[model samples]
Target: MLFFLPDAAAAVRAYARLLRPGGRLVLSTFTEVTDADKEWFQHLGAALGPYLPASPEPAPGSPPPPEARLRTQQSLADVLTDGGFSDLRFAEIAHRTVFARPEQFWDWLWSAGMRGMMESIAPQDHDAVRTALTALVAERLRAADGTLGWTTSIRFTTARRP
Candidate 1:
């Protein structure tokens, strides 16, 4: 949720003020994805260009995305400490999901954050997009055993207000 905030520092400071001394805050943010995942999304973006909404470019000198700002432990620590936090700790949790079929992968996409993008497609075009997505996944992500797998990483940060 912090990653979606327009001003993460402000939110962090507010949290610190709201907490009693020695109170702790635990938050999770996404880490960078694997190269394979990046490639997959590139392909997905290209394939869905016609149906998906266009993303506007950020203005020059704008603050970096919250995820990018806190992608690493050092950067996250800096933010927390600046917000009056101490005893910062970080951990990463990784998950690998394997779908036995391309249709399963398509279903997983709809079940997750990608649902927003999926919903952007006209109801009439859902089948077409699903067909194209399944074909794309089958061609690029399917393994010899015929399963599609993707690994995702999330960073959990714990900080104490002091």
Candidate 2:
């Protein structure tokens, strides 16, 4: 929702207006995909079918979301500044989550964009995709304790209204 704003700067200004003077605004978001995670997903997609797309295409006449553009420190700072927020600060956080069972990972995947991909596949192909992904995670991404671990980059931003 942070992205695809008609005027992201103006939206920021509107957010600033909602806060009392000297109030602080804090926002956190997933920023970039780690290379390992990207590669893992690529492998999963390849195994799924003819390379299932990560996200669906935008509707006709819809503007593309600024997912990559606003991910950097500079871009976030610029937005806060344009919104008239002061004392801006930024932080990058490394986050990790582990799933003890392969089914847990599968459940997590189906909760989001991957659900669409899974539904698009034929019934026969579904089992093969699931088996391949499960094995891939266990073999390549799982920890010694039989848990699958994943890391991602997150950005935390704070700014104060002047």
Candidate 3:
């Protein structure tokens, strides 16, 4: 969830302060996204570009996005060390999700975090977005065995407050 924070450094500092001396802090963040996932997001962005509001540009000299700020092991360690943590440990885990069909994948999107973006589309445009997304999924995600799979990389970090 660190990737979702607007100020991850401040959040990490607060976590450090909240823990007792020698206490452990463990957290997870997405480290990488599969090519399939990248294509999925790209298709969604293109399909929703006309309906969604334009994202605001960052102010001059502002910090990078949270995901980029702690994207690698070194960056994650740096943030924790800056927050006065030590004895850091890191692990990377990968997971793959498979859906039986395009409709199943569509349902999973509505049932998961992507629901928020889907909800933002006007009611009148839901069918259009659905049609566009489903077509893309069938073309790009379908496998010979008739399943769609996406893989993601996650990092789990453990640090000690000292």
lDDT of 2: 0.75
lDDT by residue for model 3 over 1-162, one digit each (tens)? 876788778989999999999999998877755666678778867866887766799999987865566778888898899988999999998877787766666678789767776677788987777777677778877668777866668789999999
> Each model's number of backbone clashes?
0, 0, 0
Candidate numbers, best TM-score first, in rank order: 1, 3, 2
Deviation from native of the Cα of residue 18 in model 1, angstroms? 2.2
Number of the candidate with higher TM-score, 1 or 3: 1
Structural similarity to truth (TM-score) of each candidate: 0.83, 0.77, 0.82
Instruction: Give me the overall lDDT of model 3.
Output: 0.79
Colliding residue pairs in candidate 1: none
Model 1 TM-score, 2 decimals: 0.83
lDDT of 1 by residue, 81-131 (tens): 999999988889887789887888778988987787788788888888888
Where does the lowest 10-residue lDDT sum fall in candidate 1? 65-74
TM-score of 3: 0.82
Error of 1 at 40 (Å): 1.8
Model 2, span 127-159: residue lDDT tens: 676777778777777767666877677788889
User: Which residue ranges in model 1 land beyond 4 Å of their true spot?
Assistant: 63-69, 143-146
